[model samples]
Target: MVAAIASVASVAARRIRGGEGVATRGRVLLTLDPGALSHLARGRDVVLVTGTNGKTTTAHLLAAALGTLGPVAHNASGANMSDGAVAALATRRHAPRAVLEVDELHLARVADAVSPAVVVLLNLTRDQLDRGSEVAAVATSIRKSLRRHPRTLVVANRDDPVVVATVEGMPRVTWVAASAGWSGDASLCLRCGRQLVAKHEWSCPCGLSQPQADWELDGAAVRGAGVTTPLHLRLPGRFNLGNALAAMAAAHALGVPPGAAADAMADLESVAHRYATVRHGSHELHLLLAKNPAGWAETLPLLKDYPALLLVINAREADGRDTSWLWDVPFEQLPPRPTVASGDRAADVGLRLSYAAVGHQTVDDPLAGLELLPPGEVVAVANYTAFADLWRRLAVMSGR
Candidate 1:
């Protein structure tokens, strides 16, 4: 009765709060029934995608790929903790399959409960330093969880040393040669604690090395299991291409044909507006979310072509309180363009840029910063809460 009431109330709240009640629903369920998530997840084919970055997009892709087989329940709004999974599963109890994005630190708990048929580990990086665990600690947590759930098949990135180390000897692991765009986090060897050497493949003097991949991501295609399919996606960035490869490999493990899965993913334009563009006074404002340094490393290069750039930073609980990670970003690599920093921590962002010798303006208000950009095309990059703020502001501006 409590489960039913919570689900119904959550649906009602979603309508009133513009679809922001998923976490609330999950919280209510867990509060009233401690085992609500595991109970709701029973008898469902589940795939849990967890990592420091690309969890949202990879979960979206995996959900889309599985949709080709049957109805899939997914946390499309990016609420990725155990509570969020409970909300998604409870609301769609009849769905045969579920693709959930799990938080890095919560993967062990969620995986132990859900016992997902497949788990995709993207890459581990330094993020949310104020409250989150360090890279090695996060990897150790996942390693222990996978040992507990021996039946789960893991699809891991071979290029990322941390990811490779996490699923090293798992019997049913499928390694994908996904690009490790940021290697700063994996400089030290996980096995020998010695410095790793990265050339064609990352290796340690103690004999730890990148494993042979069952599925390889070639430029625009994924080749594996005697098939190659081109991923024609509306999402931008090479990191997304690697994400697609991971999704395809996991889908194949679930018995879905690679071609059909790729076809299903092509229509997905964006994941919670990661690369979504909104109209602003006769100009196009492209929005991208970059929370940590690794994400910024991949996102910065993609913005080289944009005529104007706006960066928003915030230190809310959702976005780790310590803004020191901003210094790790490769702002020096940013191309010459009209740039502006806006958000609660816009001053911090501006200071970092100043040290990088990139001239920029600081505006505490995001919408006001948008107004300052010259009309043509503006690329906006923001962290967690800042992105949500700008997304809401754009919706209100358009009277949505």
Candidate 2:
């Protein structure tokens, strides 16, 4: 009774107020009945994907893979807190399985409630500077949570030393060497507190090192469990490949075949405009979203390949108030080209580019900057709120 009312209200609120209403719904349900999520999670197979990045993409892929077996409920709207999980489960009550993307900090609490069948631990990096904890602190919290849920099968990244160290010596674990690219956060050992040496694999002087993998992403193929299955994904970047591998490992732990999971994820082209292309006027804008330094490190190199690049930045509440992380980004590495900075914090990005010796202009509006570009390809890399604004604008322009 409470669940139905809360879901209906949330939908109405979303329609009237705009934006995803999972948060509102979750709040209402919890206010009315605190045990709503626990009640909905009963007698269901659940998979939880949590990390600093790739949580949304990995969860989407895992849900799609699981959808092959039956109707699976998931939070596709990117609302990842306890309330979001509650709202999704409450609304889709009949679905026998659920795959949820949980916030890194909220994972332990959410996992405590739902007790997921499998947990996918992707790479962690510094993000949400104003509000988020340090990488090691977040990992420690997750480690403690996983320790509580002993029966939950953990599918963790073997390539990430922090992730590997978290689940070290834990039973019922499947490791995936997904080739996580960002090494900035894991330069030191989490357990041993020593400098990590990286050659073929990352290891610490205190004996904490990268673990052997049950699943390995080998170029275009995923090899594990005595079979190599090729991934044909439309999503760009090695990070997406790593995400797919993490999803595959989670799916495998939950009884889905790796080949089938790979096949299912191949059709996923975009996840909340992480790598979406939009046509605005004469310019074809390729959209890429990056939040923190690690994300920019992966995204910036991709922007270099484009004919023109647009870097949008925002320092909104959701985007983290601290714009200081901008210095941590390797903007100096970006090739000299036609570039523009626009967003709420366009001036900040413009100043950063100046320090890096990269030539760029600033525009109050990103669409205004788009008018300056030639009628070919333009790659736009934006943070959370910036990407959402651009995505929403393009959606309105296309009348969708």
Candidate 3:
């Protein structure tokens, strides 16, 4: 009966707001039946994907791999909190398998409610500084949750010190050496309170160190469980390779064959807008979203050779009220190029670029900023809200 009502609400929401109503439908369902999430999720094999970054992409890969077994339901649009999870689960009650991308701080609550069969911990980094908890605090919360659910299998990233520390003593853990490019947030040890010694292998004075990974990424190939397969991903960057490895580990934990998982992941074109190219006003814009310093560090290297790029910065609540993290990003590493800054905090981004000695112009609108660049293929990077706005604008302009 609850499923019937929630289904009707989801349909109504889609009719009223189109694709934007996905989260709203979940809200309406939860409001009508507060306990609908657990009821809907019962007796299903749930894979909860959680971390500061790449959760959505990992969930997408896992869903595809698990699809080999049967019908699978997931939060494909990346709405990963309680409301979003409830919406994804309630809307697809007939599917036997469910994959969810859960936010870092909300992992404990969501895990408890769903009693997930597998929990994939990608990596932990400082993101949305003004709105989210500290890195150590989030790690602690995940540790407690893992301790409480001893029966759940954990697919953890060995490259991330914080992630390794969080799931260290869990009974069932599949460690994956998914390389983490950003190391600023993990310079210090999360467990021993001492500085960590870094190298190919990192260890602290307190004896805590990276665990031997059950699954290891060797270039584009992942080796594990007595088999190795090349992971050909359409997505760019080493970070995405790591996301694929994490997904492979989670897939294996759920009884999916390793070779099949790699083949399934290779077919993915994009995770929403991580690497999507769209046309707007006779110009092609490649969209990339970087929310914090760690994310920026990983994303900026991809634009080193571009002749010009558009960068948008916003301080909206979704983007965190604090914009201080912008200074931490190494914008100077890029070859000298004309960068057009946009969004609510356009001046702030311009100021940071100036300090880095990178020449740039400030424009308040994203589209106008893109127009300032010479006509051709261009790259546009933005924070949370700014990225959403740019995506919507591009879609409308292209009649998508």
Candidate 4:
């Protein structure tokens, strides 16, 4: 009865608001019945995906891979909190399998309620410093959750020291040699409080270190369980290759064939709007979302080949009220190009670019900001809310 009411209210709310309303609907349902989530998720084969980055993409890939086996329920819109989990499960109670994207901070609570069959822990990095927990705090929470839920199969990134520390000694762990390029926040050991030394492998003087990965990514192929399958990912970057590996491991843990997982991942064109190209007015804009310093570092390299780019930074609640992390990004790595800065924090981004000796012009409006860049395939990198706003605007313009 509660699930039926929550589902109806959620759908009605979305109809009235004319937005996706995934989060809002879940929030409304949770407000009415606090136990709605646990009740709805009961007796389901739930797969919980959590991390600082790649949660949405990895969840999408895992869910898609699992879809080959049977009907699956997943948080497809990237609403990853407790309410979001409830919304996904409540709406699709008939589905036999559930794939949920869980926030790093809320993983413990969500895991307790969902009792996930498999948990995928992607790379951790400093994200939303003002609002989110410290990287160590998040790692501690995940560690506790893993210890509490001993039966849950953990599909974790062996390359990430924090993830390794979290699931260390836990039984039924499937480790993947996922590549994590950003290490600024992982300089210190979370367990021993010692400086970590990294070369081919990472280790602390106090004895805690990265575990040997069971599934290793060699070039484009993933090797594990006496089998090797070529990972032909449609998503760009080594980070995405890592996400694919994590998904493959999670799928394998859930009895999905390696070949079928890889094939499903290859068919994925984009997660939400991370790499979608849209035509706005006369400019063809390629949209990319980079919410923090580490994300920006990974995204900046893609812009190197482009002639001109649009960089948007908003200090909205979703994007973190603190825009200070912009200085930590290595904007100096960017070559000489006509960069147009946009968003509520456009001036702050322009100042950071100035310190790095990268020339840029600031425009308050994102749509108008495109005027600064020359036409023909302009790349626009936007932080959280800026990216959301632009994505909505682009979608409306494209009549999608």
Candidate 5:
């Protein structure tokens, strides 16, 4: 009854705000109360997408790819949980379908509420150990959620041993494997309890000869669909290609036209702080988001090649203050050590670099490093919390 009341109240609030009648208000109502999800899709379909690391980016891209079919609702601002899901449905009025990028920990909770017509599981990696169960625990939670609702279309990443191994007994799954350099195998076989060996180049079982998608991302271009459009991806690195593939494959699973997939990629966008470029008094800082070992490891090559000053911020627990992950991250790979470190945990950042024997300076905020940095080129790597802190400080410093 409480859920129903929230639905009704949300609709009424939308109407009071001059919303677009029941259609728009209805989406809002359904969000506040997920029984409305069933009601809204009574005769329609919904798509639910989830993953660690790239959920927001991949979810939005898939939604945009399928948007050509009709109006598509998604968490454009990356509010990808139950509350954010409620917030997303609250505002939108019309869409043929909703493509939601949901949180890994909250996937089951929100999935039960929204009960998406299709469920997408991207690669599961380590992140937010405080707010979430360990990756293995969260993967089990996802399996349990799927068991409750059997009709949802399942898209599973085959390259991730932990993610793929969870759903082995289940036959109703579309398998997706990325043949790129991201090859990760953190978990072993559920049935054999043995670490499966990769064949066909560290991809399949026990080095057995098998067929797999040979995915080589040329810039933003993906092979294997005879689909080669001009690569217009805003983000760099090979990891993004997998995110792009997840979007493309998930869009295909939704029955969206193939052309729309490429078109959406052509018109892609980015959320704030995911490689967002900021200009402060003739200085350009590409705010790159690096939160975990995988993400941090991926950044090393990019940072090494980038011809600019390195600025990093690691403040909150979310940034993994232990910073021991840096040991595995190969910090010495970058040619020059970071020039400045700032945040509540700036010392932690400096210590990690120092341990790796990377050089650095300490500052109170991003712009403080600016006083010592040359104004021509610079890069700022901020974790989840530090990003916001740095953003506000930069905003004030820039008078924006």
Candidate 6:
């Protein structure tokens, strides 16, 4: 009965897309089975990317790269849940492969229904406290899923100890190392259960025998697909480069030819609002959804050499009830102070920024906070809910 309903929903959704060019059948199915993605795949090349951060970006890269080789199915919109997976999968006809990004904690549910050719665990970080297990616990869940699928090749970030530790000795898995040491930090050593120390801007090693990786991404600009543009991404920071490389390696592992995969990344489109740059009068606003500590840390480089205001919003229960991790951020790096504080929980965001020497001007609503921002160059770091509320205002203000 479950299969029948899902197939029917997907068929009707496909028909609607032909005329309307928009599919809602997948949205409708979300109510029936949030974990229904597992059922839709059989004898198709499947690439699954699971992690706390950068899954959306990596998935988009993989989708773009795979499109050149053959038809590909991808949840590029970042919905990422079962319904979203069905929607993406339903749009294609006779596609050879599908690249899907699964939420870290939900890997077990999704993996149960679908078999994958390669499973790429990007990196496990502390995120969504109310909903997920600790990094180690979540890594364990992913391990169980990997253990269940014996043939699936595991592609991963060797720099991340948690994921590297999970499938260390697992055979038929390819590990890829990325040159993201400059801006990102993976604190714990997955091998010895000790804090892996980093020396002279190199690897975070416990000096123990760890598994070797298969591919490596080195340098600021990437060289693949016969293109070497340096990839000075419109999106700021170095950690994102790691996300880009993970997709490149995964797509290659799934057999998308290296040259074409790089072309897809170079000709990539923004994932709706993920790291989308919008211009106001004089200031440029980069919109991103930071939901956890690692998510928030990924954007720290955004504050480099900017005297503009900083806004941090923390309200969702999934974001964690305690915002004490704000102190953990190296806010001392930001020299100047912010202009105002705003969000559903403006007080909390203000307090965090305030401790870092930013002033507090409360606007109970995120939309109202936009009014407080002077009509010049501005930077805003909003939570998912706050971004949803103020996205319209941001579009209008930045002339999106």
Q: Estimate each model's TM-score.
A: 0.97, 0.96, 0.97, 0.96, 0.81, 0.82
List model 2 lDDT by residue over 176-285, tens digit each: 88777778888889998888999987888898877888888787999987899999899888888888988988888778898899899999988867778888889889
Q: Per-residue alpha-carbon lDDT of model 3 for 84-191, expressed as tens digits?
A: 888888777889999999988888888888899999998899988776578988899889988889999999999899998889889999999887888988999999
**Which lDDT tens digits does candidate 1 get at residues 1-400?**
6567666657656653433578877877888788887888889989999999999999999899999988888988998898889888887888999999999899988998889999999999999877758888899999999988888999999999999888888888988987899888899998668999988877999888999989987777889978888878878889998899999999998888999988988888888987888897866999899999899898988898999999999999989999999999979888777889999999999999999999888999988887788888999999999998888888888987
What ranges in model 5 sit over 4 Å off? 1-44, 179-187, 190-192, 199-232, 315-323, 392-400
Among these predictions, the greatest lDDT belongs to 1
CA lDDT of 226 in candidate 4? Answer: 70
Better of 1 and 5 by TM-score: 1
Note the Cα lDDT for every prediction shown: 0.88, 0.86, 0.86, 0.85, 0.64, 0.67
348-398: candidate 6 lDDT, tens digit per residue: 766776777755577776545555666665667776656654666667666
Clashes of each: 0, 0, 0, 0, 3, 3
Ranking by TM-score: 3, 1, 4, 2, 6, 5
Pairs of residues clashing in candidate 5: 24-93, 28-90, 197-206
Prediction RMSDs, each to the true structure: 1.5, 1.6, 1.4, 1.5, 5.1, 4.6
Name model 4 segments beyond 4 Å from true: 16-20
**Candidates 3 and 5: which is better by TM-score?**
3
Error of 1 at 194 (Å): 1.0
Angstrom error of the Cα, residue 280, model 5: value is: 0.9
- Model 4 per-residue lDDT at 153: 93
- Model 5 scores a C-alpha lDDT of 0.64
